[model samples]
Target: MAKHLDLEEQEQLDEIKHFWKQYGNAITWVLIAVLGAYAAWNGYQYWQRSQASQAAAMYDEVEKVSREGDADKLQRAFDDMKSRFASTAYAPQAGLLVAKTLYESGKVDGAKAALTWVAEKSADAGYASVGRLRLAGLLMDSKAYDEALKVLDTGMTEEFAALQADRRGDILLAQGKKPEAKEQYLKAFKAFDDRTDYRRLVMVKLNSLGVDPLADAAAPVAADKGAASK
Candidate 1:
């Protein structure tokens, strides 16, 4: 029984050796490929983390300069960040801050330039939309009616549609396009929930233009109030 067990063990050992000899290179290559991929992924994650940390530090400087209302310093720092870290979200965020500071400081041209960069270069749709909205406001204030309309022509997101419509109405009103303005106001009013007081403001604007949406609904109530007063 001992001899039989020894022969069986020897056969198993030989079988394992033959298997390794046949598949050794393939097994080694497969392991190397898997390990190589894992190492590359780890390196990529580390690089991304390092870049984000550096960009965040620069963003702090940009925010500080903006809060201090130093337009020149803020512009310089913003240029540095955009040149070195334009792909980061912080770059566009810094641009927005710089634009706001410039706008508040009565630097309309500088503010427009910063906002244009954000509108053109920002990878985030939300940031781009914000830049466009603000730029449109500045253009509207300057009576660049057509340019303001173009800025708002980007087709706003659902969250911004009502505000965009309101702004568009203002621009049209400035251009003396009263009918277009009224239509935009009606769209804005319908876009908002009935419970929102903002909707009431839009309705009032429409009413001022001789298009009273609530008039039919309020007619009976107005009559009742009149009867009570009488």
Candidate 2:
């Protein structure tokens, strides 16, 4: 019986050895691939955190230079941030800050350049929209009406729809297209909430164009009521 038990144990051991011999290399490679993937993912996470930390520090530098109102320093800081961290949110933000400082310092061309860069290259749509709006204003001030219109025609966030329409109206008014300007202003007037003072300003614009938004709104209702009576 002891001999039989020994034989049984040896047979089990031989079976395990045969299985290991057949599948050992494949199992080892599969484990290595899994562990390598985990390590690569961890490394990628660390690299992203490091990049964000560096970008935040650079953005702080840009903010500091911007507050000092030093155009040269602001430009340098912004350039560095753009070159090194263009993928980060801070890059476009820094560009906007630098543009504001440049514009305030009477550097119109430089301000436009910075704004153009942000408008064209910003990954965030919101930042791009802001860049386009400000750039359009600058273009409008320069009497580049066609260019300003082109900028305003770009895609924007829904929240900026009313503001963009107003801007388009301003551009059209500058170009002496009163009818088209009035149409845009009407769109803007209706887009704004009644409770907001902005809507009142829009109303003033509509009135200046010889069109009363309130009257127009009432006209349809009055016509509907007349039809109902008839």
Candidate 3:
């Protein structure tokens, strides 16, 4: 029985050796690939975390210059942030902050440049929308109505649809295109939520154009009532 057991153990050992001889390279390669990928993922996570920490510190530097209203210093800080950490969310935010400081410090051209960077380079759609909106407003201030409209058309998300329409109305009104402006105001009025006070402001705009969106809203109900009576 002891001899039989020893023979059986030797056979099992030989089978395991044969299996490893056949598949050892393939198994080793698979493990290497998996472990390499895991190590790379960990490295990426560490790198991203490091980037965010540095970006936050840099943004605080930008905020300091912005608060000081030193457009030049703010621009320098923003430039550094853009160069070092453009992929971080802080970069676009720093751009916007720099633009605000530049504009308030009487640097209209610099403001436009900074805003343009945010509008054109920001990864977040909401951030891009805000950048475009502000950029358009600045262009409108310059009486570049067509260019402002063009900028607005570049990208405006659904959440800002009503604001985009309202802005277009303002630009049209500035261009003395009252009829076209009224049309845009009508669109804005339609887009605004009824519960929002902003809708009331849009209502005022529609009323100024000799239009009443709420009155039109009541028309449907009136028609329904007439049908019921009949």
Best by TM-score: 3
Candidate 1 C-alpha lDDT tens digits along 1-230: 99999999999999999999999889999999999999999999998899899999999999888888888888899999999988889888988888889989999999999988888888777888888888899999999999999988984567888878988988998899999999899788878888988888888788888988777558889999999999
- For each candidate in turn, the TM-score is 0.80, 0.87, 0.94
> What's model 2's TM-score?
0.87
In candidate 1, list every pair of residues with a backbone clash. Answer: none
Clashes of 3: 0
Across 1-230, the per-residue lDDT of candidate 3 in tens digits comes to: 99999999999999999999999999999999999999999999999999999999999999988888877778889889988998889988988888888998899999999999889888777888889999999999999999999998967889999999999999999999999998888898889887989989988888887888888889999999999999
- Highest lDDT among the candidates is held by which one? 2
Give each model's whole-structure lDDT: 0.88, 0.92, 0.91
What lDDT does candidate 1 reach at residue 137? 90
Ranking by TM-score: 3, 2, 1
Which digits, one per residue and each the tens of the lDDT, describe model 2 over residues 1-230? Answer: 99999999999999999999999999999999999999999999999899999999999988888889888888888888988899889888988988888998999999999999999999888999999999999999999999999987875788889989999999999999999999999999989988989889989999987999999999999999999999
True-structure lDDT of candidate 2: 0.92
Clashing pairs in 2: none
Clash numbers, per candidate? 0, 0, 0
